[model samples]
Target chain A: MSQKILTRMGDGERLAMDAQEIRDDIRRGTAEAARRAGVPELTEAEQEELFAILAEPGRIVSVEPGREVIVTDDGCSMSFYSGQDGGGVGAPLSRLQAVLTYERACGADTTSMGHSDYSYKPVKPIINFEANDYYNISQVTTAPFLYGAQPNMGLYFQPDGPCANAAELMPLGKIDEARAAQEEACEHLRRDLVFVGRRLAEVGLEGLNFDTCGSAGDADYLAALQAVEELKKDLPDLPIIMGGAGEFVLGMHGGVEYQGRRLAGLYPHEQVKVAEAAGVDIYGVAVSTATTESVAWNLARAVTFVKAASEASSIPVHANVGMGVCGVPMMEQPPIDAVTRVSKALVQIGKADGL
Target chain B: MSEALFQASVDAVVRGDAKKAEELARQGLAEGIEPLVLINQAFVPGINQVGEMFGAGKLFLPELIMSAKAMQAATDIINAAIPEGNAQEGRGRFVIGTVEGDVHDIGKTIVVALLKANGFEVLDLGRDVPTDRLIEEADKFNAHIIGTSALLTTTMPAQQKLEEALKKAGLKGRFKTMVGGAPVTERWAKKIGADGFAEDAGAAVVVAKQLLATN
Candidate 1:
């Protein structure tokens, strides 16, 4: 009911502020709701900084070339957007700079180029454009590069990047060109993966993560899976974590509805199926808590969805829970308690799944 | 043969083949089937089945959207055959869009399809639409209801701004305003002074009809 704090901020500033504020709000509300619902909340320290728990020192297993390594520690991960979280393409500038800053402020086990950072733009690779200099580092690195957490880099490989409209991706030119366009998209992604991987490895990065839910259809989704598999072939030692939809919103804070009924917005199970085929180490369900129902209610719903996903899959499952309201024409950060409750529920589900 | 043509029309939509659905519609028209009857018999039933299957989780988004697209294609062909002056009186006009600063449109698109299927004439303004533009379009279309969707907290304020803009333009009560999206709760709709709020696309139709009755 409060006037949105976002209305007063500049475009980029408002996006970052809104995302953080909504996150803060969800965290706060979820914490309180957990108390009422008899669900445990994150510890104060964990609440203060999530990556502290995620970035705990673990023995590094050497990843041999041409052999794939499974990431046992999925770790508590947060998926962010560049413009919304600050930094990246369409944002103020260097997303890696912002990532380092964020890690310094809040410990981060994984450095991910939020969906906004790598939204596929035709004829341009945002990663190369944004993180041009730090693509590769000369020495192997460990934790505390920018923050308290050990660093692992994650980027997105959307078949149709969130920025690229699906209609545009629909083949319009000559038949062969359209076929070539699809192949070109897959090739571009394969190259992007290799490019980012080599660049991060040069800087001593330990692992890789892929958020692959925004793209539609079996073909695009399967293509993304193949790209991940191909990338793994090239970097067998790097622990690869794959993310897809767990439910309707995929926690992207975008509208995902069909008919009067709310459809599972993303193909979580299908994505996991391909990911399993691709030998992805960890599968993440990105469920947003921005439903019209109470955050507790949505968390409960997410529990059911994640449980089904975990039960149906052979891999370790993690829930990328966030507070994104997709129904309202506009919204602000959800209460912080809501975020914590969803986090707690995710943690519960993760444990139940034996992750 | 008539039954076969109608069944094929239904099959085309269920299969989400837009070209085939359009083709079947043309074939049905050539066979002297009434346009409205084709819509009522085949198009409506096809979309309804899609809705049922989708609700039951047998069908997912790709199929659901394709079916909707197929329905639209058939509807377009049917509408073109009907004379312009043959208007259905009392069916409400609904103008809908995703609020500015939020470019997500799946929810709005679904709502548009549902509205059209339920007999409302719609002007879908697409996504990231400005508040003023929605009001402008609503007025231009003489809409009975203006539905706004916002997918992000950052863009949600635009819904409130739209409500305020309508009041400022002294046209607040002229159109019934409904607000929805991922973050929108009934409480937020009430806070924003919206006339109605539906949690999802199905409820939207029921609520839109209710709002029209009172209006």
Candidate 2:
């Protein structure tokens, strides 16, 4: 009864239609109408005109099977969870950097993942700015992500908020109701979605992220799926990601913290596979259950799982290892230390001798 | 119940057992171990580790929050018992809330829990709290600290307005003010005439105490 879309494009293509090289081809497609209606590129006026012509590539309408793009955001308000890479005023700075770096490395687009300080996006007066101009500008104003559609969970839940109104989140808890919680979370999610979507159109955001969709799984995974799907209907050109695994992984529910490690219920990963079956392009695997070992090992497992899952449909997979709160369960970024860096180099290097 | 019952009790909390944590906390007195020792040494420490994990980024929000609730059940039982006597007190009384036009409580709730564990008497006004309501509660409780939260970029100015109103109402110099949440910064606090700023609740307890000591 439900519909599904294929994730891979013809013959494993990777951004063959870039902005600078094939302006006319990009401008003539579905990306064009969306471009004209989206945010403007900051540095270029000529390109801004052309941006309106590009058909945004990641049309993530729902969890329905299809070509999937992803966006990653590390919530700054909840910076308490960022582990070794965190602490102080630098939390947001690190989070944005992670977003940019993660997106670049993992290859996601259409991001509304973390704090929005516009570190990369500068605010210039729209001079010769026409209110009635026919053209749209898509520029990479900030990091390639946005955190909340409305209330960043970073601000709302993290003890360090300039926060969103609480009543707005009444829906996240009411997940048992159909479209209620998803619709509720979407109240904020939508606000950010539109703002970020418009910004993506302006910043030339080609892919999209629907990461928050799966967060309400216990309450209702289908609701989460439908929420992102409905959102995709509104935003047909971006990839949508939906995944959540924090509680089950950490063993808060009478769980045993054994041998200095946290473990998870058996079914959460199954839920992830279901999200994929429900038509999602990307699946998030929380391998942090290996809290005894380290975040990298879990990340490697998660990446391996994604590599396996996405291999068949040809969808690109993204692995999420969020920041640590108390700094104990370390999720190293950019692999700072030599030990970490050397291992990370091996990961990226692809085992020349063995392979 | 014998001490063997308590070993299971201790193991349950140590293992992050939700059902067993409550059962163990309820059985602490019957098992002959002093309630305060269980509260301070075992149960509180379990959550403290959870908090440390939260602070260290080894855990995320859903886990931290669930652990907080699980830990609270054990502490709730301990709080009901006869004092095990002789213990160091937590930090002092503090009041926190989101400014008007905001309706988020996650940040406020976290700070309250963090401060409570750290020994602060916290009066949480909940979300969308009015400045006058905050001031009234602060005055009623003779609070030494007041922390305000605002999430919206549109409403961040409410923090300034709260300070100005506090000043106009002649309460500005009376209490220390701390502002936090996403839109706030240490610089923003200085500009708004807030006494201090902490980015998260764990750090908030420390900052609130330090500000209270100076004031």
Candidate 3:
């Protein structure tokens, strides 16, 4: 006699629904996503295994002792100074602190030195392309590398924020102007990323994480792909991790295309192909949680998408399991119950290489 | 004849042609059409359709932003001709920003455009704005509501701080507070004592209206 499992709404409401219904929905959603992505659907046995994990009555669920996988994180913070901006620690110290904690305390296999300048547009003033006066990338990456952590440098391509604002293209109804401005911004961002990538290579940075790629839609995705392609030309051995900001590529520049493929509305399976073409080593998949739906519903949908993407990809697929996405609830601190269940599903059903 | 011009106004907004929308608005005004009538009958319907299409996944962010821009451009012109005291009579004023240390603003930007389309005088303080500045602007603008957005878990404390600061300043009763962002949940809004929370721009408009009505 299986008991009803507890689930959560996207808005954080707790509800108890029949476990069988949840399983059925997961199967249906997963099959549809797999069919749409033109990838292999989860086998009947895999679906049953996923249902058992989701239906567990425990407060949290985890993989058995030896089935653990590699772990990576984006926007690793400096927790030294709580409530203070940048943790009151300089770049070098912050990077050191984050890597130390993730490696020794959290037992993370790899850590990231995530640097965000609010928006990429503002980086122009702070970055001296001609010299190393602006960014301390080499120093920051070197410390983590020497400390025995597989360190990756993460940056965001949030083109919608500053890029769209600066162009003022929307207000004046200048669609072409907006598209052209985004294209120009892409060039500047590509140069900046390549410059940073070179600095990382100088220090033998383990990997490069284009964290939150395509948040501003297709234009943002294009920028990251262009940068990765250029960097691979010079530093072929350098591994690149491209993490998506959402589950789909928004047609912000609805008409924009990359490698002759229109990018306005692409799912994760389709997105992986473009990332592979751009020479990305690892592809991170993000599936947004629908706040109005049950956690069971969200998890099923997320795994379905990830499963298709994983099967279709030639490279390792790392599922992004964080706040408000990948079946995790949208909260400052997502409940451990949901996180564990989501992590377990991604590993068992989605067949992800990392989380 | 008037119906044809009105439909053209609607078509311009749907197509996201700011110049055409503006030109149609001017033409309507020159033809002795009432400014409010033109907005209410023509442009509002266009924006509303865009919002509906966006919610249904028929359009994307760039299209949505473009539509909002067209609506805004036409509204700016038509709104200017209305008499000073008669305009902004019952419609409320709103102040919004992304919380300090959170630089993401696409969500907030969309909310601002939608609020403006719905006839609210919105003041967007841009991204990474401090709590003090948000309150100060709200006070100066005589705002009935102050909305703050935070995209990260680390910066969510700022929303709680805003709630505390409003209480400490004894301005809590003067204005309603709304919170939003990718990581912001309705429970967090309640925990922080915020008056309202919205998941997206379309929902923000509804929440703002509810908040204003109570105020």
Best by lDDT: 3
Per-residue lDDT for B132-191 in model 3, tens only?
A: 999999999999999999877778899999999999999999989999887777878888
Query: Which regions of candidate 1 deviate over 4 angstroms?
Result: A1-198, A215-220, A246-270, A288-290, A294-296, A324-341, A349-355, B1-46, B55-57, B60-89
Using TM-score as the measure, the top candidate is: 3
Who is ahead in TM-score, 1 or 3? 3
lDDT tens digits, residues A1-355, model 3?
Answer: 6677787776567777787787776777566556544556677787788788878889999987877877777644433323334332334444556556656667667655443443434443444441242134344433232111111111222333334452234433466776776666666667767776676466556677777687766777788888889999989988888888776775556776889988766778888999999999889899788676667767877888898888889998999986778888875457888889999999878888888
Consecutive 10-residue window with the lowest summed lDDT within model 1 chain A? A146-155
For DockQ, candidate 2 versus 3, the one ahead is 3
- In model 1, the Cα lDDT at residue A352 comes to 25
Ranking by lDDT: 3, 1, 2
TM-score of 3: 0.74
Reference-based TM-score, model 2: 0.45
lDDT of 2 by residue, B12-97 (tens): 54454668878877776666677777776666556656566555334444454445555656776767675555433434778888
User: What total of clashing residue pairs does each candidate reach?
Assistant: 48, 87, 1
TM-score of each: 0.61, 0.45, 0.74
Candidate 2 residue A320 C-alpha distance from true site, Å: 12
Candidate 2 chain A least-lDDT 10 residues: A346-355
Order the candidates by DockQ, highest first — what do you get?
3, 1, 2
